[model samples]
Target: MPIILLLQLSNQTGLLSLGDLLLQAATVLHEGVVQVVGSSSAFAAIKSDGSGIIWGDAAKGGDSSRVEHRLQEGVVQVVGSSSAFAAIKSDGSVFSLVSTACGGDISCFEHQLQEGVVQVVSNYLAFAAVKSDGSVITWGDAAKGGDSSRVEHRLQEGVVQVVGSSSAFAAIKSDGSIIIWGDAAHGGDISRVEHRLQEGVVQVVGSSSAFAAIKSDGSVITWGAPANGGDISRVEHRLRE
Candidate 1:
């Protein structure tokens, strides 16, 4: 299959034959590029057939050579971190690639990622996944959110949503409570506002270093790095019921 590869040369211009570039890249052209995703240095495209083709910087997940066999088919979605990419298959399994130090290497959680993944989210250096059972799994640089040990128990059940910042994560539970972890200086440590997070946290949002939670009673709570957004003291009166 020949794809419509547009090219421009100094003296001539036309299609650039992918004779040796990609075997199925052309076949899926008619199916069209349904979706495209990129990391710091690479990009991946999801075709109509649910297969993925990747290209760009190998270190940023642009190279899918390592997971070529898996991307040949059944890929539904691909999400990228700063240097890695994670693909979710039709069967609900997840595959990762790119800089191992950033998130490319996920072998440690292979067993847990075999199946049941429903959604995945990431920041610049880590990845978090929500399982069908409402549980969350995280992997990547520990300081950036790879480790969830401190709040693992709190995340085991009834988790409705998980949001990420540049260096941390915040999760909202079914009971409307909030759990946070990751880089303490970057919004992971919410001890300063723990009392405010105990209940009624309807939604939690974050920036690169802080998080803001909205409660059912019409109040707001913030924590993490104060300079980035943690401190709402200037507007405290406005946040009251």
Candidate 2:
């Protein structure tokens, strides 16, 4: 018989797996597999049964109706945003369920969107997709969602990660440095080093008015208006001798 397993993803329990049950002879025997996704506004999971599910934000198509049950067996990755959800299938096709600009009587043909996407990310006002070859596609408001035409150079070939702030976006490369565009005040400039950009940054986060980066050593760095960036003095102290 084929082996069976169950995997659950939840913040409360993290990732847990369970195997077969013990038979009357005390011999372990597990039959079917089950996967449970617990209470999270956003959840992503790859089950032991080789299936996947992503659910969150009804307005963004978190409801089951948006995704075909048959496709669940082929899902490999999932991602969610404030108002949208995206999933990737084993075959590399991307599926999306999102709210239309207007409410009520929305048609799936009007809201359901798909593409051959390799990676995806979404913010409050827009969604971005990075193709397998490193080019990016975006939809939603050109201002808040991102205007790819502006940073055509950085989007070329070396982009490895993308981050969005309330009003702007940033892309990080395989190297330690970053390329920022939109809303200059939001730390879009790399000419001056801020505490967060001082160390070799591994990850970045964009808040309403600032940018924050996490160093490889697990320390955080932040820049932009102090009020919005959060006082990093404490973080600096922790990292300092």
Q: Best candidate, TM-score-wise?
A: 1
lDDT digits (tens) for residues 1-241 of candidate 2: 2211212223355533332211211221133223433222434445555565434444444454545563447766555545455556666666654444311112332222344457766555555666666656655445655455677676776566778776556677666666666555655454455434533678999887677777787777666557887448756878542
lDDT of 1 by residue, 1-241 (tens): 1122211112235643456335444454546678988887777788887778776666667666667789877999999888788999999999997689898788989899999998888987999988989899999998889999888988888888899889898989899999898998889898888987888999989999999999999889988888999899999899976
Q: What is the TM-score of each predicted model, taking all chains together?
A: 0.86, 0.56
TM-score quality measure for candidate 1: 0.86
What is the alpha-carbon RMSD of candidate 1 to the true structure? 5.7
lDDT of 1: 0.83
Candidate 2's error at 122, in angstroms? 2.9
Q: What is the model-wide C-alpha lDDT for candidate 2?
A: 0.54
